[model samples]
Target: MTISANLALAYPEIILAVGALALLVLGAFMPKQTSLVATGGVAVLLAAAVASATQPFGVAFGGGLIADAAATFAKVAIYVASAVAIPLGQPWFERRGVKTFEFPVLILLSALGMGMMASSGDLISLYVGVELSSLALYVLAAMHRDNAKASEAGLKYFVLGALSSGLLLYGASLVYGFAGSTLYADIAKAAGAEANTGLLFGLIFVICGLAFKVSAAPFHMWTPDVYEGAPTPVVAFFAAAPKLAAMMLFARVLADGFTDAVAQWQQVLVALALISVAVGAFGGLVQKNLKRLWAYSSIANIGYAVLGLASGTSEGVQAMLVFMILYMVDVTGFFACLAALSRQGKAMETIDDMAGLVKERRGLALAMTVFSLSALGLPPFSGFWAKYVVFKAAIDAGLWGPAVIGLVGSVVAAFYYLRLIKVMWFDGSAGATDKPPMEAKAIGLTAAVFAFPVVLVAITWLNPLAARAAQALGLA
Candidate 1:
């Protein structure tokens, strides 16, 4: 592809790359104020998002990148999530005396990876995007260098990530050997002509790689350890936009490129979905750390997300998109509250730490309650509707068993979420409470700003933009 064509198609990534570099350099000269760094980073990302929205290449770079509705919509959601997360991290960064510039640059770099992954039209480009994103995260996870746990988490993630990357490359090689192309649309065409061992082996390896990224069960061993060890903001990042991007890529590849091999990959995805749901729902029960709990929650949520892909339809993808946005809002809100609860540079880790939180910080505790409930799929919340859409899609596709299992998983998942609530509401007796610190207020305000509207978007069916974006992306 010509440079102009590539730039036109992936202008957002280009802008983001520049933004990351600018933040890296200017951030060094700028004052150490974290708020300034965060807001600056957010402004740059928002600008890139706006530019991407207006750009109309449609498909550029010889189909190596796509600029359709799906990619655009995912970018929009990612930007919004980053916007929400930036302020949420301000206090956390300041508390730890971390470098402001590095934080925002890492965030931008991660977003760049997500943007490229969303637009990638070929397997090679997709791997590049995933690696770019993952590398940023590995550093971010261990940014707390003084903390031994954080360093260990980063090391574990890097090692496992290397294995996953190798598996993915081997799979891609097998797929290309069988199909004669790595471009998704071309591979889809090639795979439809015949069935063979090479195709199955390639797809199986590919699924295995993606499964690890998405934290599917049997491959999710890293999650709880990583989440527990990483900084809370870093953990929050994992639970939000990055999860959405990776899962979306998983769905897109399977639904678009491997559509012809639905039967073969579907079995793998279904088994993965079931196992993840089981592990995520149950594995969180014994967690002492809130971050670890959310890690398992993420695993289960991806199970719900993957259900859409197993349906093998555009409607399924649409439902998955909606589910992802909803998941992002709720998860982000929870972490915001978690960040808010931290005092004296100490984060809230155990459920007991939240004892009498409602009494301590009324507005924030209430907001956290709402977020937790929504995540559990309770009525009148965004999460309820997110799961509702996916559940309905599964039913329509006649995957009633998985749908029912998902509902059951939701209920089990509710146990830990409610455990959080119970600690805040009923489990602990009321006591004299201290007013939350300034940092807590900032994080609370940030989360509340985005979360309430997200819930309204679910209950009222009011947002045409999301639906339109989904449609444009060939989702429904």
Candidate 2:
């Protein structure tokens, strides 16, 4: 491809990268314009989404990056989710009497990196994208630097994230050593021909590293602590966009670069999925803190997505994409509900803290109930469809045993979701929470409506779009 054509193909990333730098400069010069910076950040993200949707599909940067339907699909989700996260943080920080422009800038930069991750065509680009996003997240985790728990969360995330990066890099080196190239197309060619021990060894390590990014067990030790300790809005962001980006990258690496080794990777993914589902379902049963519980919820959810990917079919990829996007909405809405509620000027962090929430904050409670039900994969909700497509894909690919285990895990996980609903509607009042910020309330309610009515209409279009995107992966 010509230089101009490659640059044209990279329009979405260029928008984000340039926009983030500009926002940073604006924030530095106009210190008090935090809200303005946030609004601008959202605008920039939306612009990138447009660019992503319209960009020509092709390999770019000499096969280091790609602009394709799958990349476009993932990038649009990441951009929109990051945009929603910005308004959420502004009110949250304002309530805490902290005003800083850096939050939006960090989010923008993080989204930029996630976009790179989705488009990455080679190991070097993958590492760059992962590190860029991870570094921003490390800073975001401790945005509330004065809070001890926030500081701890940031420190832990940084240390663990670094370790995962090391694993990824080492694996990349091994793949390069064995395959004699870093480009994914080249790696696929090499793996297809020989399927050697060294390549397989490196692939396992690479899976381990990406698994950490999605918070899949037994590498999920950091999720609960980090979610519990970080700002609620930040946790909401964490639970949504980044997970999708990592999983897309994961699917690309496996489906595009290692299709010939499916027999090997499939077993590893199944083991990871089963372990994650078991841990997420059983581990969440005893949690008191809502964030911690949701942390486990996310782990299990990622497992479901991975299950679909393990099927190694285009239908599986489509199913995974659909599930992740729907799950992202549910999780973001759940955390938005959490961020919207408070008790006597303090944030509500526990299941008990939400007792009789329906009595005082009926709208918030209703939205929470909708999200909870949807999360439990109940009928007529988005999450049910999310699980259905995944399980269906698994079964069609002769993964019935794993699918049954996943279904059982869903049943077990329903207990926590039901407990939340019961507490909100039936338990005695914990007293009225502080009036919620309008932005958070709007996001929660909007997501609830989407989870139900909007999703009914959405799935009609979403299914075909996802299938088309999956076809772009060149998967069978």
User: Whose TM-score is greatest here?
Assistant: 2
> What C-alpha lDDT, on a 0 to 100 scale, does residue 135 get in candidate 1?
94
Candidate 1 lDDT over 255-320, as tens digits, reads 667777877887777788888899999998998788888889989988988887677667677778
Mark the 10 consecutive residues where model 2 has the least summed lDDT.
Answer: 89-98
Task: Judge candidate 1 at residue 417 and give its lDDT.
Answer: 90
Which candidate number would show the highest lDDT if scored against the true structure? 2
lDDT (C-alpha, whole model) for all candidates: 0.79, 0.94
CA lDDT, candidate 1, residue 172? 85
Question: What does the lDDT read for residue 52 in candidate 2?
Answer: 95
Candidate 2's C-alpha runs over 4 A off are: none
Clashing pairs in 1: 69-473, 70-473
> Clashes per prediction?
2, 0
